[model samples]
Target: MTAVEKLLGETARADAQRNVRRLVAAAREAVAEVGVDVTAHEIARRAGVGIGTFYRRLPSREALLQAVVEDTVYEIVELAREALRDPDPWHGFCTFAAEFVQLRAMSCGINEALGTDCALSLDAPLEQLREQIRLLVERCQQSGAMRDDVPWQDVPFVLTSVMTGDRTIGLTAADDQWRRNLRVVLAGLRAQQLHTSE
Candidate 1:
């Protein structure tokens, strides 16, 4: 390629990265204030960029939301993987569950912005994360650490419900409360197996 052509391509790629960063920052702030459903134009305005710039970077609100969701899911998956390295499966399960709940709470607004449509193609990473959680939970159950009665498919749903339910109550008191509640829930899950064995 010509020198001028290569320079133009390089500049275009750099500009695109800058625009995406600006949009992502603005979207995060807006979601914190008004929730994720905020318009892309508003996010563009907040970012001090034109609507054209926003559209050029992200084709649609769904696309933007997908980016946010993917970012959050990646973090959760990393945490889960780290937890899996723990020596005890039971402790790993508890740590994973607690961290998962906290991360979900932080990303609640973005998920809300996606609305019911959130589960569309935008949630593939989260679905994969769930599968990972299911495998981890299964490992705990197989080792007789967790309750066997709890189906693998139900792990994500139960943890999500607990976190989302706490979020709805506007409980931002402390991380201790969340951890305590999780322990209680885990106890119940364990109790189910004890009852079955007896």
Candidate 2:
């Protein structure tokens, strides 16, 4: 191709990539609220682009869903890494748990997208993240900060409970009730008794 033609081709490719990012963002917002059933045209409208542009970028609704899930999963992974860096494992676990609630609540439709109706199963990455969280719990347990009898699996369950309680209790997103409830749960999670020499 001629130099001028090559330059034009590069510019067009760049524009297409920008359009793809826009569509994916819009799709994530919509799915987080309305679930994966959101229409491509709606996503296009949200992105302030034409349906043709969205189609050219994402190609299909399944593709859009996959993109959103991948983005959210990467974010979760990053948050987990940050949590692990804290010198105090329990404190890090608490912060990470709160962020998990914030992240899920930010995408209000996530419960729906994670439900059976969704086309893509973004479970594997989530499962991997869960493993990291479980390891964090195990580490804390080793320090005697957590009760050994309490299964580590309850960590994610508690995060979900925080979100659910926040929603069902009609607490404002700005409210700190979830943290308080978490504090109460944490109080119960501490090991009750230590062996003493007889």
Candidate 3:
């Protein structure tokens, strides 16, 4: 191929990659706003790209949703790994739990997608996230920092449940009431008579 042709090909590939990134980012925000059922046209519009460009990159709504979810799960898994590095197991666990809830709060669509059945192949990253939670829980319990009665399996539910604080009450995001709820839940998770500086 001529040098001019090769250069144009490289430029096209670069643009394609940029478009994919923009689409995924826009899809994330769109899902947060309109939910998982958000249309391709809306996502493309939000991404500032044409519908043809979006189709060329993500093909279908399922593919677009999968990209957004996978991106989020990967980020959560990374946070779990970072939590494992903290010296204080209980503190690390609490931090991880709070951070996890905060991350989930970013998108109601994510919470809905997780609760409902879908075709997304999230088994791998999800399992890894589960394993990390197990390790965190075990570490805290073994240190006599967390309640022995609390099983590792309950961690996810407990964290996610704390997120329901806003909905259960009339409080909106401006109220910041979920932080108080999270603090209470974390306190309840701790072993009795153990003191930790907040």
Candidate 4:
């Protein structure tokens, strides 16, 4: 092939990859709110792309879900990392927890679809998020900002409880309540250390 033809081919390939990334991101946003059952056509419409274009990039619904789930996990992990950067370990932990709750709220349907029992192993990005949270929790415990009595396994339980509670009470009324409850839980965790010192 001529150099000009090869260069044009590479450019076209780059554009195609960019388009696929854009479609996947749009699909992720839509599915988070609506659920994975949403049709490819609906995702395509929301993405401002034709159904054919979506299908060309992702041949099946499962493929699209996998892509969207991966993206969602990556975003959540990034949020965790950002939370860990806070100066105070207690505040950092709270920030992480708050962001996590917000993500679960925004993607309620996706969370429901994944179910509590399902491990995030199938999604690499989400696995990274779990690792990040584990590290942050360890940091908080080591810093004496959090209770050593609370096991790492309990962190997921706490998050799931808050998520389930939010679902039952509804976000409008539960927002401030959850924040207060989080503070209360943190306090209880810290109480363990206080009692030990006393």
Q: Which portions of model 1 show Cα errors greater than 4 Å?
A: 1-16, 110-116, 164-177, 191-198
- Tens-digit per-residue lDDT, 1-198, candidate 3: 422233234435777878777877788898887778888999899999999977776557786687677767777888988889999998788888888887667677777766667567778778888999999999999999988999999878887776653453564644655677789889888988585544
Tens-digit lDDT track of model 4 for 1-198? 422233234435776666566676677777777876677887878778888877776556566666556556666778888878988877787787877776766685457544554422345555677798898888889998777878876886686555435344454555566567666665665636565777
TM-score of 4: 0.73
Q: Sort all candidates by lDDT, best to worst.
A: 3, 2, 1, 4
TM-score, structure 3 vs. true: 0.84
TM-score for each prediction? 0.72, 0.79, 0.84, 0.73
lDDT of 1 by residue, 50-145 (tens): 999777666677666556555656667778887778888878888888887765566656446323554335456667677778778987888788
Each candidate: what lDDT?
0.68, 0.70, 0.77, 0.67
- Name every residue pair that clashes in candidate 4: none
Model 3, residue 28: what's the lDDT? 81
User: Pick by lDDT: which candidate is best?
Assistant: 3
Report the C-alpha lDDT of model 2 over 135-186, residue by residue, as the tens digit.
Answer: 8788778877678887888777766666544354564553776667767776
Question: Model 3's lDDT to the true fold?
Answer: 0.77
Give me the candidate number with maximum TM-score.
3
Candidate 4, residue 171: the lDDT equals 43
- Worst 10 contiguous positions by lDDT, candidate 1: 2-11
